[model samples]
Target chain A: MQIKHAASAGTLESSDITITLKPADNGVTIALDSSVEKQFGRQIKAQIEAALKALDITAVAVEATDKGALDCTIKARTIAAAYRAADVQDYDWEEINSWIN
Target chain B: MAELRRIWLTIDHDEAAAWAALLTKSGLAVDHQVEVTFGMFEGETLLATASLYGQIIKCVAVDPAAQSENLLAPLLQAAFDQLDDNGSQHAFIYTKPSTQAFFQSLGFKPLAHSDEVVLLERGYPDLDDYLHTLQQAKRPGSAAAIVMNANPFTRGHHYLVSQAAQQYDTVYVFVLSAERALFSAADRLAMVKLGTQEFSNVVVLPTRDYMVSSATFPSYFLKDRADLAVAKQQARIDAELFVQKIAPTLGITARFVSEEPLSPVTAVYNTELAAAFVGHIQLHVLPRKAVAGAPISATTVRQALQNADQSTLEKLLLPSIYRYIKEHSSHAN
Candidate 1:
């Protein structure tokens, strides 16, 4: 499956990226375009979010284009968008338990 | 060179005339005419001038002509010597940041910053209200004793605080907030806060003039206040009452101070104040903590920095504090 993400400022060229994901035996396979590759190195936020979603047995494709978002904020936004697209209703358990235990 | 004789005194005059002259000359706004006493000192031929208001002293001056000859050292020494002779309990001095080195050369330690003064107390005053306030805020049956100073908030200070925390359920660290310190009060408070962030139960507050001023006996700022012993004593009596009677309204009880043999005058005054307490507060003197070649003193830390001995300073301060000094020094240069 494929997902495309685009982000831009008011005037500057909108930095964009496309990602392709496939469910594997153990984890998920992620492929990134050159634009995203230059901005965030390979297997960065995109792969991390895909792996998190795959943990719930949801095989999904996700892509994001970030315009100067900090690493933490990017990770949060990507994870949120991924969960919403997958229609996962109970991902909060993982977040809450991470803080508790 | 001839030896200079130091003469210290607390002068009584109508507040309107004396302080008004001072304010007008110094270009400060004159507001109220409170009955205030000025603490002054004369060495050989009045080399330097200073004034004390409650627990704060301001306008410490050394004649520019005599600056090359370093007149403040002898003047300060004379002030302390006179206080000792008169049996006065303590003395305190406040100096501007630019002139701190001059006073420090004469063994005047840098205290925490207040609004516009840095305070140096010759002796520690009693913490009766501080103790009572602690008792009132602490959990039932939980008692607290805190000895607060600005040791520039180093590792050694952290060690002392952790030790104090072990003995009490809650510890109140009173930072001297006088304005005369070299580092701004905000910086001192930040250093202290960063240094002690690991301790959960320690509460930090400012020690206002009422608790740490030379106006209280034994006078800790000027020695000549001893010559006017009766008036100095009355001022201290009034200041102590102000602390004991008024400070409780602010919730402070029991004060903790590090034990220092070099300054026995402070020890004696602390004893007297504790004895005078009417069962509402207490004073605790923690034993001095020494770490091999260095004693955990702000004076020693300053000396280490002045000597540019980073190794010795590192042993005395936390890594963050050492970094802070290095960063500030680079920026200054």
Candidate 2:
């Protein structure tokens, strides 16, 4: 389902990422802000793009503020924001639990 | 003099990368508030570097080869000059454990520490200043204090302070000093002052760095990062600062807080504080005041404002706070 509204999840806390999203007219516009941008900038961008692709979000505006979060946390937060934007009351637990299991 | 010249690095400076590399190598990240940076140079090489961001002194590094008994004080003195010139009386510095005692000698008290670094501060966080200002104003009896953010100063806040006012001879309400919260510190403090004016014996003061200021904890943990290990260390540091410094300064017999049915972070914080302060001071975890069977909370008030639910906001907030914050929307910070 296409995301219809703006939503955000996670926080700017260290070892976490706060991902905010809004509907985009074209392809996904990804903007990243990270403390470790010098070292992990490319990797963080790639990870977020991958997370979006996995969630079947073809087009959206993504603003990610990362504070040294790992790949799993990045994916989890992105998925959460996407779910909220899609107006889903319940999350796909099987997909979420897969991150841990 | 030529061998030990001080160099200031700016983003456009030729050696900015070298300065950042030095900090990165030292297990430190570049501070966002990269104001004026000072580096000690020996001819063609950078020997030592320290960056001053506002009153915070961070991104410090001294080349291992340049280590000596007289390395730090001169560098710090230069930074202190800049701070003093800017009228900054208090400053905080982060340094490795090995260097804690060195800074302590210069009158910088250790605030908190983890396995990696310890935070030390000088001057401005002076509990003495707060005491002097409040000393004559202190009512003649046992006083209980509570530290609150009072984001928009909801009735939930009123209920807590009202309870404190009734129970103690005086209530010292220390509003959170950090302006990191959504409701600007100015707005929150103003609303709190207006809302609590009814309590004759209540005096509101900024918590400053005495309670849980950003300096008292790892900056990450203060940013809502839930690391229990870090939280425990930070809590111990805060509790000790309260017990040994602020409490003694204010003559506080008890500290009151609304019980958390909402935040897990607060739950851990209150629990840890209680455990550490068992014999020293009293911790009052008051039950949450409810309205129509639901807990009255600042979060609820903020939600009401966001949804444009005037009736919910009316029930959640007092008239004074309503007047100030009715049109002003805020979010959890």
Tell me the docking grade of candidate 1.
incorrect
Give each model a TM-score: 0.41, 0.61
lDDT of 1: 0.48
Chain B vs. true chain B: TM-score per candidate: 0.51, 0.76
Best by TM-score: 2
Error of 2 at B154 (Å): 1.2
Q: Write the per-residue lDDT of candidate 1 for residues B1-333, one digit (tens) a residue.
A: 424532223243443254455455544444231222222324223444344334334445554544565444444444544544665434555445566655543334443332343445433232433445544544432445443446477665677678777776667675656555556667677778777778887777665544443333324433333334323333334335434553354344555556665544444445545554447665566676777854577767878777887778888888888777677663443
Q: Write the per-residue lDDT of candidate 2 for residues B131-201, one digit (tens) a residue.
A: 56667566678999998888778888899999989999989998887767768877888888999998899
Tell me how each candidate scores on DockQ against the true complex.
Answer: 0.01, 0.01
Interface RMSD of 1: 31.4
lDDT of 1 at B9: 30
Query: Which stretch of 10 consecutive residues in model 1 chain B shows the poorest summed lDDT?
Result: B31-40
